[model samples]
Target: MNMRRNDVNDLQVKVIPSTINPSSAELKCQSSCRLPDRSSFIWYKNGQKIQDETSSTYEGNFSPADSSSCALKGFEHHPAPSVCVHGQSCNRVIYTDRSICASRGSSVDISCTYSSDESITSSFWFSPDRSHQWQNPSQPEDLSKDSQYAGRVQLLETEKGRSTLRISDLRESDSAQYHFTFKTQSFEWRSSLPGTTLTVTALQVQVIPITVHQSHMEAELKCLSSCSPAGRISYVWFKNGQKMMKEETSLYSGQFNPGDNISCALKGHEDYRSPSVYAPKLPSVSVSPSAEIIEGSSVNLTCSSDANPAANYTWYKENEDSPKASGQIFTITDVRPEHSGNYYCEAQNKIGSHNSTLHLIVVTDPGTAITIAAGVTAAVLLLIIILSVFLWMRKKRASNQSSEAEERPDNRERTQPEQDNLHYASVQFSNNQADPLYSNIRSDQLHRHMEEQEVIEYAAVNFNRAGTAPRTRGQETGEDPSALYSTVNKTL
Candidate 1:
């Protein structure tokens, strides 16, 4: 009896955000009439039954574009209207979604609140796009009455001041800057202030290539609209045309098989999905030089794969426990006999992984090596002999130059004309001990020698003391003024 009554009515769902401005939520579905203990409930988003959501309670981050409702499991036919996901009811001309992206050929709702101090005489939405086309450009016209928007525009005043502008059969030409204007008796809210923008676009799935240090590499895909605003948008992803697990807001990030196809739709417009982007093709490995690798030469191994998201590359040698290298090009600077091996490169992305192998053989010839070594050794020996000989000759030349320099003075001495025979003369100093040379002061022998050598030179003396009349030097000496000293008679 309770089950029947509950079925006649409808299930009530409460949607609450975790914060005032929310990106996450908590939801509960309840039935007024008591049903069986085993009674189950299902979740619905935007009037569509959410796959695999059969719990009475829901906890997650949901798209702001979505509205949510709930239903009893067996009576899915009579669920109540979905309440908007947002709990925001802010005053003023605050738009619930400042930027809205909708699929072409679909419908979208842009909501805002316009309140005023004076009584609102008139309230409506206008597009700058249609205003430019009007005969009078200064005065904006209502979008619903415009011929271009005929039969496709709706204005619903949800409450006293809240309003929603719903546009159906969205076309790319319908993309425009939308504004809400409200007029009071004294003033009009001008369109100069920026308003909400609506973008009508077809969804596109794009692969965003990334280089992650992790070994278990996963490619990241992003859902994009052409010329879209730069921010995170909620999305629904599909793999092989099947809805991905629980329909996450973020696209799938994991390994995928070769035949698998990936596609995505904007979260609110899940019915209009983009074309599928396929996974990686078989990887191809190629070696540089296209000839046998030579000893002591560089070798390059390149790997490539065709995929929606470009593939990351890792290189491995056949017997190595760890990856030998990473990147599309793996280079061995100096290939040697020990480097000969079977190597392979694996190309991977979120979609899948594929690899191709290459064989390398480092060629070495023992006879050629020995011959080259012998030639190098012989050349080095010859160079050493030549250097030694050159150094020895240089040393001999230096010795000769030194000997010539030393003997040059002696040779000049032998070549010089003879000087006059030098006289043998000696000046004797007395042992008076107290300035004996000045006391006795006689050099007859030196005088005689000077006479014979005809080389006489003399020094002068000053006998005048301070404060005395300057004496003529010869006056005290009683000798020629040219004479340095005559005799010093001490107390005689």
Candidate 2:
């Protein structure tokens, strides 16, 4: 019958030296393939299975000529690659822990254990750039000699088999794999396969809060670090610099007051506490002219609130979704009636927000009414001036007519006759033609009488002897003697 080959291709065993002792070492074994249930491994030395050495690894003192391999217990015919120990006895370096993490701006200690059989000359840590060859071919490189880690790097502890490297003000650029190299009296050795890896990080705080009511009176808070800290972590919470809560967990639940400042930090990192945020207070609004507001007048409004961080202000009017204005002081120039409404101001900060409302009552200016009254008064004065001018012109015209009538030429001629001593009968004529005196005169007789009178006006009359009247024949002709006679009286 043909035998099946065991598929234990990745089974391997190796020896790791301890830094404390150069000659002592520990054996470790692993396999890439999963082993069958209840399966065990066996160890081999120099192509020979040791009797009753059924484990995969063996830890004991061994010479450099010894070679070790591993295989499954049932599949002894198939074995892994043999690993042989190399290098001189006294020229080896080892490290204790190969990884470390530190906070930025803080200090960290990188420590390791090493061993040397020969007299040691020097030892140091370095990061090798494989792409570039060392400038000095004979000397081991040191990171402290580089300009990058000059003052920040220091050797804290150095001894025969142990050393520590301390770096202050750790920066993110400091994150790299570092190796430990040592020079002996005759040989130099560097541990390059596994080096100490460093991680530099910064600490930050994040706060989460939950509110149950409108005013944020009752709430819950959680203080969390930006990165989860290794090992056990404890939290400390503060309110206005007074310690409020200390717990292993990062959560706190309590009621908050207006303007209460809250912050939190990790127990060890108290100097980098979270920024304190205060609860928002109700905002107060005031108008410049506290009395009645008037249209077409200037007005100023101010909003204020108490908060840890100064609040941002926004102004709003009733029935408007967007803000009408923004700032601590809101100004309205030449305020109009439309500006009258329920105005509100919101003051907000990172923690919370609040608002205050004020009713603006814009009234019509009394000066408007005064302007109208002045205009009416001016019109009435103008009308009185026009009426007075009309009345004066009428009186002046009547006086001029009377003066013209008195200065007529006919009146002057009549007065001159009076000065000549002429006797004349005064006649008064009525405007009515129906009177008996005027009606009895015929048109032809009146015209002849006027002609005869004109001729006898200045005729001289002689009286007979004594004052006897002269009779004329005109009396028998039916003409009145008085009508024919002319009387001319002269002063003696």
- Top model number, lDDT: 1
Q: In candidate 1, residue 85 scores what lDDT?
A: 64
> Which residue ranges in model 2 land beyond 4 Å of their true spot?
1-94, 105-107, 127-160, 168-173, 190-194, 217-269, 273-492
RMSD of 2: 28.0
Question: Per-candidate RMSD vs. true structure?
Answer: 20.3, 28.0
lDDT of 2 by residue, 372-449 (tens): 667888999999999999999999999999888978878779866645553232222232322212122225654465
Model 1 segments beyond 4 Å from truth? 1-106, 113-163, 168-177, 182-188, 197-258, 262-271, 274-279, 287-300, 306-311, 336-341, 349-352, 359-492
The number of the candidate with the highest TM-score is 2
Summarize candidate 1's per-residue lDDT along 1-492 as a digit string, tens digits: 446734425456687678744778888887666666666777765434564435678877776445566666676544543466664321135456545766765677888766554587988898876776877898878888889889999999879888899998788888887878777787576534346678788767776545433343346777666745335666789988887866556455665446678888766667778777775678888899766467888988999888766778899999898999999999999788999889999887655677889998777875665676679899999999999999999999999999999999998786452234343322223333323133233378765655765653433233434455544434546766333343421111
Q: Rate the local accuracy (lDDT) of all candidates.
A: 0.68, 0.64
For model 2, the run of ten residues with the poorest summed lDDT:
433-442
Error of 1 at 339 (Å): 4.4
Q: Positional deviation of 30 in candidate 2, in angstroms?
A: 4.0
In terms of lDDT, model 2 sits at 0.64
